[model samples]
Target: MGTWLRRVLLGGLLITQGAVQAAEVTFDDIQPILQARCVMCHAGEAAPLGLRLTRLDELLKGSKGRPVVNAGDPAGSELVRRLKGISQPRMPMTGPPFLSDAEIALFEDWIAGGLKAGRNPPDTPVAPAPLQRPAAGQPVTYAHVAPIFASRCVKCHSAYGLMGSAPEGLLLNSYAAILDRHERVRVVPGAAGASELVRRIRGQSQPQMPYDGPPFLSDEEIQLIVDWIDQGARDTNGQPAPSPVGARVRLQGVLGEGWTLDSLPLVVGPGTRIDKAPEVGDYVEVRGRWGQDGRVLVERIRRR
Candidate 1:
C-alpha cells in the first residue's frame, strides 16, 4: 500500500474506535455530570423545568409525565436543548457547563441507541419489568415501595449514588431506615397535611422535595401518595381503608381497557370532561354519580 493510503486507513480505524466510545453513554458518565452540576438544584425543590436529572428511572420518566429523551430524537429531547445552550441561561448556571466533545458525542450516541435506561451492560443489569402497582389497601412491602422511592425520592437523599449526598443524614436506602426516621423532621404518616414529604411536593412547604418546582408531582400523584400514607400506610394485604372523599369518581358503560379511577374526575365519554359532580346529560360522575348538569348522581358501575 502507498504510504499516504496507509495513513488514511489508520486514521479511519481510529475514527471507528471513537465512534464506539461515543455509543457508550452509561450511568457512570451521565450520573456524575448531573449530580455535580445539576442535582443540587434540580434534584428537589429547585428544578427549573421539572426535569429531574437524578435517578435513571426519573431520567426515563422525564418531564410533564413524558420521557424527555424520546430515543432517537435528540433534537426533541430537553437534555439536548439544555446542553446545546439553546435555552436561556445555559445550564451549570455559574461556571461553564461545558461538556467535553467526547461527552456530547456520547449523549448523541446514547440517544441514537434507544436512550436505554438503567445501569449499563449485562454485569449491572436492570430489571426489564414494567411499572406495576401493589394491590390497594395492602401493607407496604420493600419490593413494591423500593421502586417508588428509587424512582421518586432516593435520587437526592441516597449516598454513594447520583443526586445529592445524604441531606442531614436522611437515608432512604432501606425500608427499616426510612420508617425508623419517619416521624422525625420529614416523614409524617397519617398526616399528609403535616408530612414534610407531602408538603414539599405540594409546594406548600419550602425547599421542595424533588428539588424541581411545579412539575415535580402531578396533583393526582401527590394525592394518591398522600392518601396511601393516610390509609395507615399499609401494604400488600392489610385491611381496607376508607376511600378518599371529594376525590372519588365512578365509571359507567363499556370503557377502554387500562383505564382506572385512580385519579377521579378524569374526563370521560365524548366531547366534554369534568372531575367534580356533573349535572344530568353532562356525562360526568362524582363518587358513584353518572349524570350531567349536576342533578342526579349514579352509583359505581357494575360489571356484567
Candidate 2:
C-alpha cells in the first residue's frame, strides 16, 4: 500500500520488517494502531501532562502544552524519545508488551515523513542512533543520577516547576545545581543515608519526591541514586567530590574466579565482616561499597 518497502524495524519507525526500512507512511496508517495501543491513559482529560492520543491533532498539540512531535525529525520528538526510551518512563504505561517494530515504524515513518493524515513519501531521512551503556561495575556518578532527576524531578524543581522557581532555592535540574552548596542542599554526596534527597524519596522524611505519585522512583532507580551517593558522589568521570560515605549496597550473586563476585574482584579487609565462611562456587550476598581503587571493599559477606 505504501510506495516504500518495510524492512528495517526500529523504535517504531517500521522502515525495517526484515531489515526494516521506511514506507510511504501517513497518519492514517497508524491512527487505528494508536487508538488501540495508546488511547488508554493518554485519551481522556486526566492524562498526565494533558497529553491525549485520540487524534493526530491532539497528539500534535503535545503534553504540558509543549509539542511532542517535531515535524520530520523523529530524534527531536519527545514521543519518539519515550517510545524508544531515550527519554524517561517508556510509554503505553502497560508495556514491554510495547509496540511492535512494525507498529512503531508506522508512527516513526509518519513523524519522520509528514506526520499527517495523507500518504506521503518520506522527505526526511531516518536512521537509528547508536546507544551507549556504561562499562561493567561502573561506579555510580552524576552522569547516572542526572538523567533520573531530569526525568522525574525537574518538572517541579525548576523555575517553571514550583510557584516561583526551585522551592527553597534548591534545584535538581543540573549537576552543579544539585551540588549547590546552598543552605537547602539536597544531595550530600557519598552519604545517601544522610542526604535530604534520599530521605524524602525513601519517605523517611516529609513529602516523598516526584511529588506526583504512588508510582515513585522504582527500587532500581532509587538504588542507582543510592549507589551514586554511596560510591562517594562521583562526577561523570568516576571521581568523588569530597562527600560522605553512602549506605552499603546489598549485592547477591554467585562467587566466581577467586575472590570475585559476579566477575568483579572483591577486596577483603580487616574490617570486612564474614559469616558461614564463603568459598568459590558458593552463592552469597555481599554488602560493600566501591573503594577509591575501583573495586568492592567488602564490608560484609555471607554464604547464601
- Which model scores highest in lDDT? 2
Please, what is the whole-model Cα lDDT of each candidate in the order they appear?
0.50, 0.66
What does candidate 2's lDDT look like per residue over 166-199, in tens digits? 6767677566677665453456665565456786
Estimate, for each residue in 68-155, the C-alpha lDDT of model 1 and write its tens digit.
Answer: 6778888777676667767533444322325566666666667876766545542332232333446665554334434445555655
| Candidate 1 ranges with C-alpha deviation above 4 Å | 1-131, 134-145, 182-185, 235-304
How displaced is residue 62 in candidate 2, in Å? 2.8
Which candidate achieves the best TM-score against the true structure? 2
TM per prediction: 0.34, 0.44
